[model samples]
Each structure stands twice: as structure tokens, then as C-alpha cells.
Target: MHGPGSSGWLLVTLCAATGAYCLLRMRSSVEEQRRAAAGEALMGFGMAAMAVPTAVFTPPAWAWPLWAAVFGAAGVHGLWAARASARHLHHVVGAGAMVYMAVVMAAGPRAAHHSTTAGIPALTAALLLYFTAYVLVTGARLVPVPAVAGGPGSTGPRTGPGAGWGDRPELARACRLSMGIAMVAMLLTM
Candidate 1:
């Protein structure tokens, strides 16, 4: 990201750590979680790589198109997976956003800087709004909500003593939230 030295490094650290956690989540006994974790891990790592400060290491011109191609395949995979569960739709959007950023950076100097532009592209603004809402909704879900007594569909917290590290839904939600925040930051830089 085009941030100050410290902030850019912070984003890098945050994303890398998130990617590591997602890798651990892949050990989940649940097949579904294992699958989801694989995709999230890709997003986390990709964001980390892209967020590296330009001054420290600007990728070669060819790297941008290669980046776009990788994410394009990821988006396609996400689209196919979404058929099984709607949750995978988020992955599709995430991959698409990464592709968009890669393409913009490859377009030329002016598009890459973005600040020289008169206004944000409608697509970028739309992506920002989507990610912002995603972050808010995911964060809200993380809050502990009290269970009402004798409520029709009331189920207390889902945590269980036997649940493995990879099986914890809260941690997964947290992982998603972090990625959403990272996406927003990346878009702002674009």
C-alpha cells in the first residue's frame, strides 16, 4: 500500500499473520472449513505481497499481469465453489478486487498512483462500499450476543470444549474481518 513506511509494514505484518492463521485453519477436520481456509489463505498472502511498499520493492512490469492472471483463476474457482454454498461468493468478490487492482497498476504510471486522477472510478467506490459493509457486518457478528430464555430459535454460543483450533467459527470470522480491513486499505491506496 502507498502509505508511510511504518503503516505499510504494519499492513504487511497484519496480512502475513492472517495468512498463517488461515493455513492453520486448513487443518480443520471439517471438510468445508478446510476448503474455505484454503481460499482465505490465498487472499491473505496475496494481499500481503501486494501491500509491500513500492519504495522497498516495486515489482517488474510483467509481475502485475501475472498477478492478475493468478487472481483471475482464483475468482473462477470461487465462482464454481459458490455453487455449493453462498458464502463462497465473498471469495469471488475478493478475488475480483485483487484482479482489478493488479490491472490498474499495470495500466501505466498515472493509473497506478491514482492520486493524479480526478475522481475514484465507480468500480473502486463500489468495491470500497462492499468491503466496508462486509467489515462492519463481520465485526458485528463477532460481538457476543446474549441468548434470550425460551426463545423460539435461541441457541447459546456455539463454542465447545472439544472444538479444535481449526474448528472455531469465531477465529474464522476474525480472519475474514482482518482480510476485509486489508482489502479496504488496499483500495484506498489504489
Candidate 2:
């Protein structure tokens, strides 16, 4: 029973933790420039904007402006994806779902994420689905990470910021596992 008065701290916590993991991966080992940039940006935005719309925790009406900003960013992301030259299907679809959620969050005629109406939960579920896919694909594709910079055996991408498996490989897998957990939470809450 998704009831009122339950603070959104759980969602907030999961988002923040996963977001940190992604940011760390981006800063420490991501070789692909575009991937690093996009990953970090999404990490920040997704983490910060996750908790909203609970009864006791309803944001100030003033937050409508912030929600407006959120909607704008998500909307533009969707727009660029639409015009993208060689796009990753995941990003395109993810951004589109977020664009819709941002709209709903901002122009809400009072929508609960877990309401029986299903629309809001459906959108949240879609976002979770996309992120889950990203986690799986990225996690599997992460190359052999290295130990120290010039350890006896260095199996790291020479181009990225650092050469260490401690942060890189673990971060990718962590992102996948954590995001998978978040997906389950989203489904339950929704």
C-alpha cells in the first residue's frame, strides 16, 4: 500500500548513491568523452530531481519554477535526441520518457507516482526500464580495468583520466546493480 506521509528519502537515497557511482565512473575512467559527459550530466540531474510529490513532503509551490527548469532540461534533451545524427537508442528513448514525466510533474493536476490511474507509474516505470538497460549494456562492455598507473600488468584504457580497476570496473557494475535495485523500487512505489 503506497500511502501518504512516507518521506521520499528512500528514492532520494538510491538516486544519490547511484548518481555518485556514475559520476565517479565518469571522472575516473570513462574513455569515451561523449559518454562521460552525458553520464555525469544525467547523474546530477537524475539524482537531484528524484524526490517530489509526496503528501507531507510536497514541495513548496515556489518549486514550480524549479520543476519548470527540470521540464525545460528534459524537454531539450528530448529535442536534441530527436535531431541527433547518430544516436544511441537508449538515450533517445530515456530522454523522451523523462520529457513526459517532467511535463506531468510540472503541470500536475495532482498525479501520484503509484496512483491507480497508472499513467504516472507507467512513465516512471519506463524511465526505470531505460536506465536499467543502460546499466546492463555499459556494465557488460566495460573493458579490463587496471590496478595502479604503471603496475606490472596494466590492463586499462590509456586514454581515460586514470588507469585503475578499483574505481572504473566496479563503478560500472555498481551502477548496474544499484540501478536495477532502483528499478525494483520504482515499480513497487509506482
Candidate 3:
């Protein structure tokens, strides 16, 4: 079977690694954080699968509706999650977009991708824009900000991770930025 090229495989690797990290984060001490990590892990894996080169493994006929239903359910859950914490709105939008992309690729008139068309191109443009912005914003956040001293809200600078792999929140944010970059590249190839 045909397979992904070097760049495609690189994106796949990045996404898969992100998913793995998120899964590991599920073991965090905090229950709420664990739940959020679980959701992110699922999204990471799903996006990795979606990024796979179509030539390698075209999504099966049943995959369209199946993924639609799955993402739709995730979207609903994301909405509820957002109600509790506005941060989850991104998750809701991401899930909904996954469902939309799945449908467009599977059932649109230009499904074969024989020619430039409206559906996939438009969707890709939107995703690219969103992910490009996500990458930039998250990348900026990765920069260390010095904490204020003696300030009411200041916790002071965080000490480096000691024995563990890395800080969970920071790692998660890095993963998100990585995936955002990967998605932008993958979508461009469409």
C-alpha cells in the first residue's frame, strides 16, 4: 500500500507522541485534570488518524458516519465541559470541525480529489487558519514568564521538574502546539 512521505510521517509521529503524553497525564493527581487530559488524548489520537495519508489507508465506507457520530458525541460532551470551564470551547469547536471534515472528505462531490473544489479547500483553509493561530499563541505561552515577587497573585517562579519527565501542564501545552503545527502542515497537503 502507498504510505506517507517523510513530512507526513513526521506529522504522524508528532501527533502520536502528543497522544501518548496526554494519556500518561491521565495519571495526574488531580481528578479534574485527569479528565481533561483524557479528552485531549482522544483528540490527539483522532487527529493523528485523520492526518494519515489517504493513500496509506483510505477511511472505510463505514468510517464516515462512525467518526461523525463519535465526534458529535465528543462535541456534546465538550459543550458541557465548556459550561463548567470556558477553556473547553476549543475542544467543542475542534470536535465539531472533525465531524465536518469527515463528512466533507467522505461524501462531498469532490471526494475523489480529482480537482480543486470548494468543500475540502474551504475546510482546509479554515482549519489552517485556526491551527496556525493556535500554534503561534501556544508557542508564545511556552516562553517562561517571570513571576512577580511579593505580589498577591504571584506564586514565584516554578522550580524545574525534578525526577519526572516534565511538568504536566507545560508538556500538555507543548503537545497542543505541536499538534497545531502538525495539523497546519497536514491540512496544507490536502
Q: In TM-score terms, which candidate is top?
A: 1
Over 4 Å off in model 1, which ranges? 113-118, 149-162
Q: Candidates ranked by TM-score, best first? A: 1, 3, 2
By TM-score, how accurate is candidate 1?
0.90
TM-score of each: 0.90, 0.54, 0.80
Please write out the lDDT profile of model 2 over residues 124-163, one tens digit for every residue: 6666666666657665656554577668656544344456
Query: lDDT of candidate 3 vs native?
Result: 0.73
Model 2 backbone overlap count: 0
lDDT (C-alpha) at residue 113 in model 3: 51
The RMSD (Cα, Å) of candidate 3 is 3.9
Task: Name the TM-score of candidate 3.
Answer: 0.80
Q: Per-model C-alpha lDDT, please?
A: 0.89, 0.52, 0.73
| Candidate 1, position 137, lDDT | 98
Which ten contiguous residues of candidate 2 have the minimum total lDDT? 1-10
User: Which stretches of candidate 3 lie above 4 Å from their native place?
Assistant: 1-4, 108-123, 146-167
Q: Summarize candidate 3's per-residue lDDT along 135-160 as a digit string, tens digits.
A: 89999999987666876638643555
